[model samples]
Target chain A: MSTATIALLGQPNSGKSTLFNALTGLKQHVGNWPGKTVEKKEGSFARNGVTYDVADLPGSYSMSANSDEEVITRDFITSGKADVVCILADSSQLERSLFMLADYAGIDAPCFLVLNMEDVAKDQGKTVDVALLEKKLGIPVMMFSATDTKAYDQFYFTLERALKEKSHINVSELEKEYEKIIGYNEIKEQIKGGNISGYTPMWLTVKYLENDKVVSAKLKESLPADAASKIESIGLDANGAIATGECKFKWIDELLEGAVNKTKTGVKLGKLDRIYTHRFWGKPAVVLTVILGLLGSFIPALPIMAVASIFDVLKNVIGDALVSVGCPAFVTGLVCDVVIQSFSYIVKMLGFVFGVTLVFGMLEEVGVMARISYVFDNTMGKLGLQGKSVMPFLVSFGCTMGGAAGARVIDNWGQKVLTIALAWAVPCGAAWAIIPMLSTVFFGAGAPLIIVVLLLVMILHMWITAKIFGRTLVKTEDRCGMIMELPPYHKPKWGALFRYVFGRTKDTFFRVVKVVLIVCLIFYILSYGSGVNDTSILYKVGTAIEPVTKIFGLPWQLFIAFVASSVGKEGAVGVISALYAGGSYGEGFMAAMSGAARAANLNELLLANVSRPEALAFIFAITFNLPCVVALAATYQEIHSVKWTAKIAIYYTVGALILACLAYHVGLMIW
Target chain B: MKKLLELLKDGNSRTPEELARELETTRDDVLRQMDFLEHAGVIRKVPFMNESNGCSTCASCSGCEGGCAAECKGCVPQNAKMNMGTMWEVV
Candidate 1:
């Protein structure tokens, strides 16, 4: 059997994942490695009649163990399992990649040097002598693209021959280097760990030198106290030893010196990149983007209003058809109020979602978002964040799903989590989707005032929450730093925007729609089935929640709606719609809010609770509450902790309660 | 601590053992509180540790041109002090 259990390792954007996917196809998943939550992926394919188990370790610059991911990569390399490691490098960014490869080379393990993205290197008009590099490094070198199958096939043949004969590589010329490495395998596991686990080697050593308590604790559990203390004493303060390893990035320099010779010169963004990365500019740039993004948000919100109005017309036409069909009164009411209301709400939610997606998609599809990142690099620094990493924070406002999805762009763990948690505080489109509905329904006369107040409260709440959270959740020393490559501005591609929006929206819609529909249907059945005087479930539930609702000037039934809102905020809106269609929102709010107008056969607007100022509080509260079950699942999945997910729920619940209460009063004051 | 930091920042070179001796502590003790020093890139290891064991109690050939540069290969004494280079600073 050909030993093709190739493990790809390198720094970020070295095209490792791309090559892995290309070699094994997209049929894979990010699973755990042994026991840790760090993403582990495995894919298998048979080549030359041998089963090949390919592992795609997390991308990292060195195995020095600064981060958990680095540790994992280091461990995998040091772990005897990998038959042949295909260390991929971006030929353009060889210095850093090769620096990491140096430690691997220090071990002289079986490896294949794959220089990926050859096309990009060529496009840049650079020539690398593959044979010369292979000769110099004393290892097999393969130049190919994961995007191109033809290149992979040629590379595959070379890999096949090398795998059949391990240690065929002769490093006799580098006699001293080889001798230093030959018997050093015994010391591999002696390296402890850092902020994460004990598995990754490079990070462990760095963390050890840095004297990171977390890393040291793990190491102390395994090694002697005297030894640990001695190691801790030698390096610069603590992390100095780790930093030294990275500082001595001579291997990276050598790799660049060996493989790359630039043919053309473009205006590199050295000054521009640095200018934006300044501390003063970082915060202000972020402020401007937020203001501009918010202001422009209205421009993009137009199509949603049109689409929502279209749904309104469609519902009206359906209502007219129902009247013509001479359906029973209850049947007509149920169809119009319950089903129609939910469908229209869905359309409204989709409209706003698609609209926002259109704006962001256009910005990202053409790769100009990096310009926006550049403009605020300095501002990001002032905020103690890596500039241009604000998308994850902003997207959480639209939906935490988007927030989590967008966080994939950020590489730093500390920054990614903080950005995610902070953005979850932002009010989503679903929250604002409550506005038009409220404006049309209850406060038919002063609808505009109520809508304005609700919108104001959402913004104010986000600002306050952001202020408090940004100050607290982030650590004191994590002074934001920006080191981003500003991509060149390009013409916005319409088709790409459409595809980006559709792909995201479709995935999101499918994930959330079923829960919403089921909640809506369940609420409809409960309110209608139980609300016959004192016998109906609605009447019973209202009575049960009456005291609790009274504290917030709401009826008892709203408690049930509030509980379901945790599943998805729209579910709360859906339940309200169901209640109104069941002749309960108007009846129940009056029953709950102390003599609310008693009206029979309410308009679609009235049945939807679209206009009540307090409905604004309820909507926004639900918006900010424990994220929908999907989000809860996501939070649990991403963080890999059920307890943390529950803690997040507790946090949001308290935040929602306080914010909603304040919103209810402030909306009253403003309106 | 302040003087050494300033000197390092100003690009002064001092061996870890000398600094430890000056501080009147073990080499490990001086190295233990090296937080800001490391962050600021003040203290570093000599490039190669090949002769580190040999010179721990003997004459340091690192600073002299007599060995690689000092042109004196093996006549250095065991009790002589060490001379370090930044290359061996954990790299």
Candidate 2:
């Protein structure tokens, strides 16, 4: 009995490991390659009294020296250690998987092809003519599933035959394909018959054209200096690896021209995708979908919002009871105004949070969100950024600070700064919570219209902001096209979607409660002066600023809340709960004393007190305000430019106020 | 493959379907060429997040505040924008 060393080679995920394990089960040893961390596997199997030693080469994309694994695989092949190389390619995608075989063509080694995953190819309506492929390649070709146990009989027969008659892949067709490249023949002639042990001149020339560092170094060392310099000039004109890669792919296509046949299936977009991906209709389709999605969220939110009103009724009952018991006014206000009012608002905010998270999460889970990005990718380009910049903007819908962090993917600093700058205009999660809740309060059944208007305004604001900032931050020359692989739409996993929504809503509940309670407490203190006309310091300051605040259509109280929103959007709600409900403290006290009806619910109180125009203005103001101080810090961290961060903050502030003024005037005209 | 690179030189992003349509080929062909192009260093995949540095930078970062260091659910991953798809750009 003699020993035959057989090496198995393939690209990553070509079922190489499955075949190796099938042949060497329980007899294999795994260790790292010499001086490298890449795993090496060696095993033996005795068949027909001949013991075969098998080396499983590390899987890589190609035989190029692009990585440690590729170098090791090529070195082992060229070292003449293997009697025959069994190259594997995925039959289901021979156009791609055969790339390894194509790259291996010019080597002076005995090899045969194994087209694995034949069952998968058959299921896909493909058939590979093995006899034709074998004749074309001058090698033994087998198409079989490595997972099939009985397939090893044919594999053994092929291996024995491959060993008995040493065969090299027919390179006549491949060399013809390479001859078309501008520099291939010139470089091949310069290095012809050069004293390289394993690589033919054709192989060395292709590697030199590819700028493969190791091969280039070796070739330069072997060839005379004059010949090497001449070869270098010719290789410089080639497109390096891309040109050679084209050659390999083209050659593979030709090799499979007759040997591989498949039923043609043209790519077709789904019905909904047809509308979503339409060039002219895509943006409007996406915009309409988002608007409808926002409206759809309110259905779930309405119930939770109604339940939150219970907290309002509880506020009144607790206050009346505390007052009846002769509780101190300070304790009464703390319990009824700060604590109850803040809890009510936080509960209401959670409803919107849950609704938005569910709607958006479902959209993501079902795959519409990707279409949204596809729709906006061109718009991103117009904004002086790449298509990838749309990702951070989409993230901004959940959190502006996160959007800033997502900007890390953009390699160009100017585009990154501009992306973060534009992302700020998109209202974040907190804004989404507060704005829609406020819209429902002010607009009633027409709240969805307010959301639509806001979305439109948001688009306009981002466009103008990009124009204002893009001049200095991003240059047109820095832009480039991108290739997007849109994922196919599929049924969403309901379990995961609800888990995320419940998780996000629960998170918002805690975060909102903390901010709202703190802001409410502070405002309650500032406005707690014991006077008939509500003449506390906050009252005084608010009245004094009333005229200036009216320009933005915000009352003094709402103006102060707008100011607090810069701290966090949730803080704005706290201010509203304190100021308005604290006014209830005085008004409710007067009503209780006179035996008139106690002040109505907080909703009615707000409706009677703040004009519809003022409410609209306040909503726009807070929605478009600087997201929060944390977001401000995140912006600076991402752009690393205090000057630019401050610039963006100021821009959003002024932009919000302008948008508010416009919305207020529009509201006044409507009413 | 070179034609695909030529199409991208216009600085306008396109989907694989669009590229296939423009190149007058099947989507699989376009994808296979893209794989080759990407490996050859002609194009690169655009990552949406730098997982290593994203959370490490901000200590009080609200996005990662609630022990979601491994995956920030609050601030990022708000939706399926990540599921939107894979993107590659010319290098």
Candidate 3:
């Protein structure tokens, strides 16, 4: 419980968290960092025999104020108890770093700026004289390498000294001048009091000034009852307010003089920005990657299967050990059912994150994501989409959670809605897990074929919804604006890479394990309490559902478990395992299915039953139907509309039905 | 290990846990060096591993346990039938 408070602040992707972690080690706690899900990381560090508490605020370019980070940073500094505020800046991108620093000039805190990743700057032949910077900002500015202990130690001492002094060094008059643009006191209180609603007024003001369509809805919300007449009277569209905001940025530019300096334009800082965010390239790139993903699936699935098998072996062995230890049936299930299952799910998630994130991230980091926008950028024009709105759509491919997270990058509201709407179509991790489970258990060699069809249908359905949602429900705002940044493409550093896959997989698996253990215990109680004769009804239920399952050549028990799939993929797997002998999950439905399909020459039969192309389509239809339940709830949260959640659920359900029919009857005739 | 370090320094993908496991050591020991390497423009680090899974020799974070690091090569999809060649252009 150190009394000293230290704040680490920076713009998005500025390595602020890295510095915080370097300083704090495991002595950290995470919160919304002042009500922002934007991740507030605080840690305790003892240096010079004095322990200091450090708060790492969310990244923001400036407090001249658009995002919530500006509010958090403002609150932390204005609290008046903080000993020091460490502003970590990316040395490679000083202009951007300075942009934020320039905004912070209004805060009167003893600022010690750390120009981080100096190694990269030097490697690129960029140099900054810290003495020169220290003179420029009138603060103690240290060029640092967090990787090196000596430099890190020097930084620690700076924090130690700042804690000792506990002084508040105010900003210059130059910064006060920009306060009119970045300062937001009214919103700060509202946020702190938990009463702030929909983009703070100041945040809206800046966005409106920039003519950002994202907040056009909010702007309309802000208008008087006769807003339409006011707009008509002003002869201004949605951008009238935002246009005024961007105008002030130029005024603030004058205040930025002397405080900020550009060095050699930092070797094409804005280069490679356009080609990817290409009004045309952005969306097309998305399609191409998807096609590539489908193409890659043929080869990759085997390795994925191999990795999974390793877990199966471990689980079987562990289960036997638990049984031998005389562990109760519940305890045995707790270890094998919960722990092993959770671990397996975590492993699968890691595989997806790195496997998909790497490929997709490489494209994105290299500006390929922007290129993807090109193919579909104009698609927004048809439905009225805007900048940053494309983010959710682009993110939808990775997973819905990613799409939800990607929504953060959307600077405006129209894009947020568009991205979110499309995100519903993106099968989340749970859905991804279920399709594989169903396919492998049933289809065998045809598993990949089924998986591919489901994904395409999701995308097509998403596009239709985006188009419809834009035309009828939400007004579309399609502005061809691009954000450009040129970063030297390098290999991914494994140490720093945060694998969302692992987190998600871990989450999914835990959900599975916890619920499974609970369910087992509950069933254990029912079985013992109700007596074995009556308790056996659960098994009977697994058997009774078979006649309907026979249509798809699946076990009745699978359909029973699948009923639970709506809860989560893991829930389904857990239930399915419980139904089997020794409660084994056994082989997946896809593998079993493909073997059955091959023996009966079902592909040809399906072609004859429906149509040639419809045979493969039939398998895909069942696979794509309503993603497991976790995704449904997530979609509900992101859209924030129960009606729309149902709409998305129904859309997938219908999609699954249509495809399944097409695959079954058409395959009988065609193949 | 040196090649991996060089790869990381070159701003290539380098997982510290993988490298540490290969080096037969703890992740904590390698943590400082990885950061140092990153700071020195010797590597780039992505937050892909959770501590719980990163060192799990089982099919945990070290997903490619008991296998060649090269197995990760199959991660992305490609159109080139030349499966013999590298999928990622190893810079």
Candidate 4:
């Protein structure tokens, strides 16, 4: 049988392997290239009483020696081991897939182009004229799907013609494009055509200018010292790759100008994208969307909020039954105040958690969150940070620890520290849970209005904080540009979206329960026993700090809860449940003495004990406070500077108090 | 492609659509050029939230163990910014 060797070459996903498999069937052996990890495939097939040997070259983007696969592919084709090369391009996206053909222009190998995936191109409303492309390329070309078992006849026919004619790509047009590059002619003049066995002198010159290390070193070794020094002195421009790449792309576009027809689906932004990406309107539009989404969350939360009342009923039933059995007041207090009250608060907080997660998760699912990131990316640049800094800020919305961790993408230390500092201004998941829950408790139907105001204040807080820390933490010159690919909007996968929401909420429930129960039980025992309200260290310490805390409009109990929030936002809730329900042991004492009615629930207790203005101040306090001790550790872990981490922590704490003070005054005016 | 690089040198951020508009070219053309620039090392992909999965070790060189497809339970909540999509930066 007459045998001929052919190599299949293409970019990744260009259907090279599929064609290789179809051509060779089971007669294939896969092994690594000698001393290289890149896979080497060799096989043979007999057709029409003639044997054809197929070598599948490693798939790569181009002929440049960027990776082992690329080096091997280039070396094999130039080594003249293949009688003909079967170059493949995906017909569906020839604009991109043809890059391999463009880069392969100068190799002295006879080849034919196989426009694979013709079926997919037809599906996308694209049509390629095989005759026209063959004329333009001056090489055999066929358009057929690699998966089509019946299409091999055309492939084999084209291969035979390419072998018989010894056809090579028409490089006159491509060489004219390359000649336009600076120093192309000068470099070509120095390198002889026959010096490199497979690479043409024009190709060597282009690769040398593009700073291909292999090509440069090879030319240096072969050229006389004086000539080599002249070329070396020309130097590698940072834009060398860009300029050479532009030439190849321009040539590809010109070659395919009339050879390929595609439906005109122009890249135009949708109406929503227009507003969401507008230069001035983008920020306001994103801000408004987030506020509206937060308000929408309350709708889902209302049901879960209503469910929390059952805990109050359970608390009364359990408390009264324990009392009827002559159980001690301590046991009743532990069961009613600590266990039931903390769970009631946990359940309420979880409602907001579920609601907020669902709304935000749905936004992310439908691809609107990417727009939010795009909008804020510009803002990040204005803050003397890289666009990527916005990523950490976005993550902070979920958890400050995660945000601090996300800051690792920012390579600059100063910028990273500043990013973490500013990320602290964004409310974390726990703050979202607790803020809306408390807002509804204090403001009722006006909770949405409060959420809107908090979002506005958050924006203001981030700006002012950036101004304060930016000068020292980030340099103006340390900024760089970014390009983003906004994902197309699609229908939300409700199953996945809801699954994530429920999973997050469930996690929050378990995590919050542990923190709240522990914090609640500790504070409860500290305030238990006869007149311990007067004698307990917590009460004395809380009362002693009341004067200092009152400056922020926080009562002693709320102020203590504000302190507890530094450990965790849920700990603040635990403190509130314990302090309000236990109440200087007032409920039990009053029940024993004057038969005064016990507070109906924690809501009634909070309403009786804390004024609206004080409640508002406390909300602002915990909302902006240092997210948690875990976040602090994470910040330290990232920044690796105790000084900066401590500095950020102190700044956030002081800033939170200042915001609280301002919010209290505003609340007093509204009330 | 040259003009695309020049536009990015202004230290501003742009989405692919905006770049396509500014360059007076189709998004596919712009994307093709980006692919070339990326492979040629003229630019680099910005490893963002979706790739890193917002995990703590992601910001470090160690990378996520399973590279974002695997769940990194508890370190970062699942599905955080999973749809933020890809980003690139000029080298």
What is the lDDT, from 0 to 100, of the residue A605 in candidate 1? Answer: 38
What tens digits encode model 3's per-residue C-alpha lDDT throughout A1-671? Answer: 34677888787667777788878899998777544567767788876556788888777655533456665666667566567888888876564455456545535566677788888877766777676556545667777887766788778766665555543323344423323433233322222332224233444434333344534454465555454234324323343332332233333344334544444332232344434344465455566566686445434334665586566567666666666676665555545545554445445434443355445544554444544553444455455554334445554554454455445444455456556666656665555554554455456567666666676676677667777666655553224322111233454443323353344344555554576555544443332312223235554654566576546433554455445555544455454334432222223312222222212221122223233333244335434555445456555555577777687677766655565555555555744
DockQ of 2: 0.59
**For candidate 1, lDDT tens digit of each residue in A1-671?**
75457787877788888777877776667788776778898888777688888899897755555567876876676666788777777765454345555545544357778777888878878778788787777777877776787886788786775676563234333323322332222222344322232234443554444444555676767666655565544433443443444333433444446567767453344443344334466445544544444435446555655565554556556666766677554565556666665666666556545655566545544443454544543344444444324555444555665455445444455555555555566555455444444444455445445544544554465456445555644543454222222344456666655665566556446644665567767776676643344556676768887776655534455556777877777677676666655544444543431212222233443545433546656655676676566666655555565655576677788877776677667657866
**Model 2, TM vs. native:** 0.96
Q: For every model in order, what is the iRMS?
A: 23.8, 2.3, 17.9, 2.6
lDDT of 2 by residue, A1-671 (tens): 98999999999999999999999999999999999999999999999999999999999898899899999999999999999999999999999899999999989899999999989999999999999999999999999899999998999999999998898999898899889888788888889947898788888888888889999899889998888888877736447777778788888888899998899868889999899889899999998899889988988899999999899889778888887888776787788778987888888888999998899888987889988988888888888889988878887888887888888788899999999999998899999889988888878988888888888888898899889889988887788889988888888888877877888888788889889999999998888776443668888888899999999999898999999999999999999988886743346544542212544666777887789999999999998999999889988988899999999999889988988898889989988
For candidate 4, report its TM-score: 0.96
Largest TM-score belongs to which candidate? 2
True-structure Cα RMSD, model 1: 18.9
Regions more than 4 Å wrong, model 3: A1-286, A293-304, A310-354, A365-367, A373-375, A394-419, A434-451, A477-488, A498-509, A515-558, A578-640, A666-671, B1-91
Show model 4 residue runs off by greater than 4 Å.
A583-596, B53-81
Over A331-414, each residue of candidate 4 has an lDDT whose tens digit, in order, gives 788898899988888889999999998898888878998999888887788888888887788778878877888888788899
Residue A627 lDDT in candidate 4: 93
What is candidate 1's local distance difference test score? 0.54
**Model 4 chain A: ten consecutive residues of lowest lDDT:** A590-599
Give the winner by lDDT: 3 or 4.
4
The estimated TM-scores of all candidates read 0.50, 0.96, 0.45, 0.96
lDDT of 4 at A484: 90
Native-to-model Cα distance after best TM-score fit, residue A128 in candidate 3, in Å: 19
Candidate 2 has an fnat equal to 0.71
- lDDT tens readout by residue for model 3, B1-91: 2333443332222233344555565443344333323322333322111211223211111344553332211111111111110001111
